[model samples]
Target: MKKYGLQLRAPSQQKKAAARPPLPPPRGFQEDEDDDVEREISRQASKNKALKDVEEQHKKALEEDPSVFDYDGVYDEMKEKVVRPRVQDREERKPKYIQNLMKKAEQRKWEQEIVYERKLVKERSKDDHLYADKDKFVTSAYKKKLAEQAKWMEEERLRQLREEKDDVSVAFSAISCDGFFPLREEERLRQLREEKQPSVEQPKGDHHKRGGDAVAAARERFLARKRAKLSLVL
Candidate 1:
């Protein structure tokens, strides 16, 4: 059978190794020393030549333009021509009219602030007055209530004193007179016994009298009400 599309081949022979140049023979001690000295001398000479060339160019530039070295003068001129004027313009004061307007605005603002503060103070004072009035009303009402309570207490105390005095008088009256006649003493003792008894059963005549008085009072009240009704009707 024929070989496939591409035939496989062995790798080519390896390339020959490159030959290195032969190194020079070792120099004598004096020769190596002389070579090093020569190289150092050439390097230093070249460096000095480069520095001298730079110096000459700088000297020529200074001669061509004397102003190149006039640093302070140039700086002063630049400041005078460019920087100072711009700074002065930036820092310039406002015109009188503008200043006046600004002052007016500030004054108006201060006046408005003063007005607002006064308003606040007035409102605060009004509120304080209202609070004071409320507190006064409460305090006065409390004091009045306390006075009423004290008056009621005094009235009650007087009523109690009167009751106690009446009781003492009744007790004193109940004591019989010493060394009186037997009949009078007996009569007095009987009166005291009667007085000590509760008066739950009033006399029939007194009861009738009281009932008549109540009836008359009721008749008077009824007449008054009827008269009031008739007046409304009329």
Candidate 2:
């Protein structure tokens, strides 16, 4: 019979499988027992063929290159290079290093516990309402608010003063000698009476009283001058 490289079954094995009764539901709950059996046989055959191929390739490689696996005491050399030093280090230094690490860990844990206990005690002893009274703490924000309020008040006062001064200037413009300088006092009186009139309203404030009084005095003086002029004319 001709040999096949990777046959799933030989001709005699195929004849025997055909002659045997149908496998009894594949020993498990498979719906298609024939297909499941064929697939399982194919998988096993492939696995065996793959293992055989690997073996043949390994033998061919060894035949072609005999020096491929020439260890030549390399195992001993690797052991000396890697394993011996690690073993010696473990014997000589690992124990002491482990002891020092454990000591330092214990010391660190004790220090942390002490610090935590001290913090807990301090918190327990301290007053709960230490920062309750907001007014007791004069922060920069509070100071800034006071400064803004004072500045606003000062600006308001200055504004009122400016208004009062403006009113006084309007009421007594004839008294101020900016450009009008009459040669005779009588002409001056006439000019004051004719050209100047109280048109500006008085500002209402405690500081504006002086300006109001000045305006009233100027008006009274103008009236007096007019009366005297009238008498002289009579």
Candidate 3:
């Protein structure tokens, strides 16, 4: 067994993953535009061995095995540290259901419910010791600054809402004046009534003219009413 060092990425890390190597064409296979299905299975075993080597190295560096490193009053994994969980190698573990595993797989890939761990790198143990003591001070300042920011944010949000209300009121008045969109039909009708003109008066004296006009007018009205009723029924 060999010891190795673990390097963890910081929050500010923004590096992209390294580009994959160009793939070779499959052996005894034709090279069509969509012919990437048959991989060279011969190389898979080599790839697996390389992956195992890397995993072994990572375990030596980061993992706390069951039988290693027992210290006094404190188990050392992180700072004054702690004993990590005891992992066991089992020969006969029960197989998981495909549907449940599929659901978990979906969650892990898309929703990120699956947690991944990376160890923090310390330049020196002394620096870690300092942070443990002053974390409360840092936390307090951070909280106060957050509170101030939230207060301003809330105030601006309310101010925006008030401006929106004023805009709505102005738009209502403009639209009603232009008659584009009637916000309140009752209000529009009331305004129309206020701006109404008086009706003209008609003469009422000639008997023969009045009798003929009244009979013609009554027949015309009856015909108009009949047409309207017929139209409605149709």
- Candidate 2: misplaced stretches above 4 Å? 1-135, 174-183, 186-234
Ranking by TM-score: 1, 3, 2
TM-score of the candidate numbered 1?
A: 0.26
Candidates sorted on lDDT, descending: 1, 2, 3
Give the per-residue lDDT of model 1 (tens digit) for 200-226: 765557645554565455556556545
Query: What are the RMSDs of all candidates, in order?
Result: 46.9, 37.5, 45.3
Query: In angstroms, how far off is 122's CA in candidate 1?
Result: 31
Residues 91-138 of candidate 3 have per-residue lDDT tens digits of 122233556688657534422211111111223454677677664434
Measured with C-alpha atoms, the lDDT of residue 84 in candidate 3 is 29
- The clash count for each model shown is 0, 0, 0
Comparing 1 and 2 on TM-score, the stronger one: 1
Error of 3 at 209 (Å): 51
Clashing pairs in 3: none
Q: So what's the TM-score on candidate 3?
A: 0.22
